[model samples]
Target chain A: MKLKNEQEQKVKAGRYGKNFGGQYVPETLMTELEKVNKVFNELKDDAAFKAELHELLNNYANRPSLLYYAKNMTEDLGGAKIYLKREDLNHTGAHKINNVIGQVLLAKHLGKKRLICETGAGQHGVATATIATLMGMECEVFMGEEDTKRQRLNVYRMNLLGAKVKAVTTGSRVLKDAVNAALQDWASRSEDTFYVMGSAVGPAPFPEMVKHFQSVISKESKKQLQEQAGRLPDMVVACVGGGSNAIGSFAAYIQDPTVKLVGVEAAGKGVQTDKTAATIERGTVGIFHGMKSMFMQNEDGQINPVYSISAGLDYPGVGPEHAALAECNRAQYVGITDDEAVAAFDYIAKEEGIVAAIESCHAVAYVQKIAPTMAKDQIIICTLSGRGDKDVASIAKYKGVQIDE
Target chain B: MSNLAQIFKNQKVFIPFIVADDPDFETTVKNITALAKGGADIVELGIPFSDPVADGAVIQQADLRAFEAGVTTQTVFEIVAAARKETDVPLVFLTYLNIVFKYGYARFLKKCQQLGVSGLVIPDLPYENRDEIVPLAAKYDVDIIPLITPTSGQRIQKIAKAASGFIYVVSSVGITGERDSFFAGLSNLVAEIKEYTDVPTAIGFGIHTAQQAAEMAKIADGVIIGSAIVDIVAKEKTNAPQALEKYTQEICTALRTKVEQ
Candidate 1:
């Protein structure tokens, strides 16, 4: 049963790589997760599934979102030709809708009537609620109690979309705790419920499935960029929370080493301080939220309480695939401080008249940092993963500006 | 490993669980002794982790209390080392994979051997994901107890075939907590597991009362009462030793009555 060196090398590479992504969930959820994997494999290549999914994305969530040429910013930076992949234009105003629509279709095909998910900034919560309403399935979302307060507008949106929001109040009461609540709920009711992981950081089929669905970002941009710009961009940038958007935006270009991929993480105050969410920068190899990924934890393996001004980018771990990519240097990951992201947030909205989500602002901040040093002809595409309206109140609060409640 | 197997011989079994250092380290040591004095066949100690996705509210709160008490892996081991002085009760650490993976596997397992801790019951480390550490666990003579839920289906054979010391048969398809009723045809699945492995199967999850324990032990070799016991600890706090002793004795007396029949 032993293999040759080539096969051995392939064997050494795990589901994501040698060190990430597996089914480390409870045995109670094993059969359900396995069924999801089987169903995904069957439907991924099915022409009918693809056609249905494409139709929904086009007519419902707004597919082929405009890849805008940021002419003003390009001239302002005077370094790289800037392009913004406008995932912000999608229904629910975030790239989260792409994966939501895809997963809801899968849940429908599997004859599941209940949908459960976890959200941080509530983008995923709103997206899941929107899609579940369209599909006429029951939707329940878990959000950190603090996040529910921070993004009350998103909570109301989810509620109006017919999804019940559960405010989680354990273990730092943030995105990770929301994930904990959702997983426990799924473990209790997997027979009739489908757990839609918002990020590409969980165990096996989830990371792969979320990536497969969100890959539409890069799939459309690659073709659109070729027709519009007549050449591939030198770099593609996206923010990494649990890395769904980053992986999706990088999916098409990962194989082409010429097109560099970058994932920007929130550094909170600074990586040197105890208040950073820069997992890839200051994390050890550990397992949590079911995947073996780079996580901020102590020597005793306790998950650290991560902090960020942007609720969307505040998690202790990066996606498993991102960890593997970082390990092999296939993609570059950098951290942005709160001040930098806020500056980018205001600048992008004013300069391009495009309000970018604070999560996506992390990537914008990074692009701003390096764009000035690059050749003007060199192009870089940054994915605006969500519209910034939900973050407007928070940004105002962060800046000590008075806002009416 | 043999010590764990010895507990199932010629009689039905009772395994009581509690979060180590739930209120404090002293209570944990006293609680283990109480369980042993109350006829516990084995004791399952929960090492608190920040995220315990497979545990229900009662046990989750217990973990929070333990963390508030500043429990660490070293503190849990110190509790275990202290308890070993009072009783020879077969002890196992029920924890998440990160707890062990974060602590070097070799070092963790070696420490388990040194402490006479016989097994592990990691809810997250399912059959497919435990390949790398199985041999290392065996090298330390520590049992990596396999879990088979109602949803395990055909995976039961694959898991049970290689399982040793014991098999944890989850009575329902959910996290660890009490339920009004378990899933139907559990005895059939227990029968299926029996066809594949010789290891004793203990039905847990939802078996809270002595009545439930007696009924579940009829189908499997033993019963595991967790959240209910932790609930007692949560309610009684430092005086959990008294409550746990009475509770363990009730379950044991119920199991013994079933054996006599």
Candidate 2:
């Protein structure tokens, strides 16, 4: 496959279908980002690269996870049939590993010596650390100090994988600050460093690249659903942070107009309150983290400090593609409050015996509210993005269970 | 003559940047007068943004301090307008794109024009997306300055062609901070930009001390000192205006030295 020039790639990846994405980055990082884009463009069509990536995904990270039908929950709701796309069963215990493995392999192919990334819940950091350890590369992860405190086990997990986790204290001491710190690190050492962007956010190639890697989830679910349920699901749902899993789960179904896509955001207290990360519901168009996206910001254009029970969904900005999707009405984004998400966390554990991350519970919480309204023959597939083991301590504290960390 | 052209006409231009309302708006106003009196040809007044990804630690902290001091877009503009009453020094806003976008592009530029601001230096607004904000700036007679970095490669020519006022040549690969040494190809990068446009090219980022100013002035038409000046404001607190004036005087003196032919 012939690689297009940098300008052509920018046109395709920088904005949404018509407008919304572009590489609005400092000049120092442009060359490196463009280089990665060029290589990724060629490798996407290269059969050898595809074969190797598939081998790694299958043999290492365990692709084609089960599409389990939640019969009890479906029967209880008495409306839509609910199916869980069990991404929580993947290696590293999350859907994050899928994108990390692809980017880590691409970094190796590009001959980068170091891997750097920013994480909110430490899922992406742990996944990146796991891959970096396997690939023999130096790894550095920037995590918010607040997040490091909440997700302490994941921090230890990354450290155990031989990755250095730097706690960023600047700004609101959350995911966006971690992103700023990671970009600072990359700016000074971009020559030998590959920034493994954790989600479908940031500059041009990242949103497109991460979606390509995570599209595996929907690809497998599509085939699995057809075989198991004998038809396609009526609606697909996933939680949106920077929107990696949501975009991934919706990628295969985007062209299938019959399948309604829904993205649930973390509404910490409420969207009406300042403590929320429901960017699509409450945010306006602005540029942050190198992408033109819908962001929670002030009239002065400063990014507002956002809050959520799940550290993973505490980002002020949504991915540009999610913004574009929301704009086009292809995907409807709704907010789920923290209290509701906590209830869903417990409800899923009892009803289906499946423990989901607080982040994923946002999607489950939304499904619990809407499933009963649809017809019984209709089906809804939600991406259970990660395991709840990492959130047990936080959830215990939230529920007043008093577990000592 | 336009304020930018006049500032660059006679000698090697020396511009000092300071975040407005660092300690307070009054101190920022005092610093602007001090900077102009200290022989600064132009002054880059930065409006504090919540996230300044293009800057290093020094300026980032300064932004925090300004925000803590209750600096808003309106306050920064009011400070600049106050400074305009005291001096004729060309003032250019060194801010992020989001600030301008939030303030409304045309409105912001019009305010800049009303307050006698000479230009704008938005680090994130690269050449590719200049169309979003440049036309409004041009309408308001505010120069949207272009930046050329060491890795800009062939894009320097394209950026330089559209350059207004002058070109900002970033001397290092990273965000703004003081450095002991710079990229070896900086002179070559400046020369490449020169071939495409006759606009005065001013080198910035990591330019500290009188000797560094003199070294950069040899290759470019001017020099911009930011973090070094911001560092002073961060340390001196209430006395920042007087201290920054002394520092700017020494750097400007060195910048004016003629290169040996």
Whole-model Cα lDDT per candidate? 0.90, 0.90
Per-prediction TM-score? 0.97, 0.97
Residue pairs in collision within model 2: A14-A21, A14-A22, A15-A21
Each prediction's number of clashing residue pairs: 1, 3
Residue B41 of model 1, lDDT score: 90
iRMSD value for model 2: 1.0
Segments in model 1 whose C-alpha atoms lie over 4 Å from true places = A1-14
Instruction: Identify the CAPRI category of the predicted complex in candidate 2.
Output: medium
Prediction 2 TM-score vs. true: 0.97
lDDT of 2 by residue, B1-261 (tens): 135866677799998999999989899999999999999989999998898999998999999999989999999988988888899888899998889988989999999888889799998888888999888788888999988888888788889999888889999988999999999998899888878888898999999889999999999999999999999998899898889889988987788755532
DockQ of each: 0.85, 0.77
Error of 2 at B114 (Å): 1.8
The TM-score, computed over Cα atoms with residue i paired to residue i, of candidate 1 is: 0.97
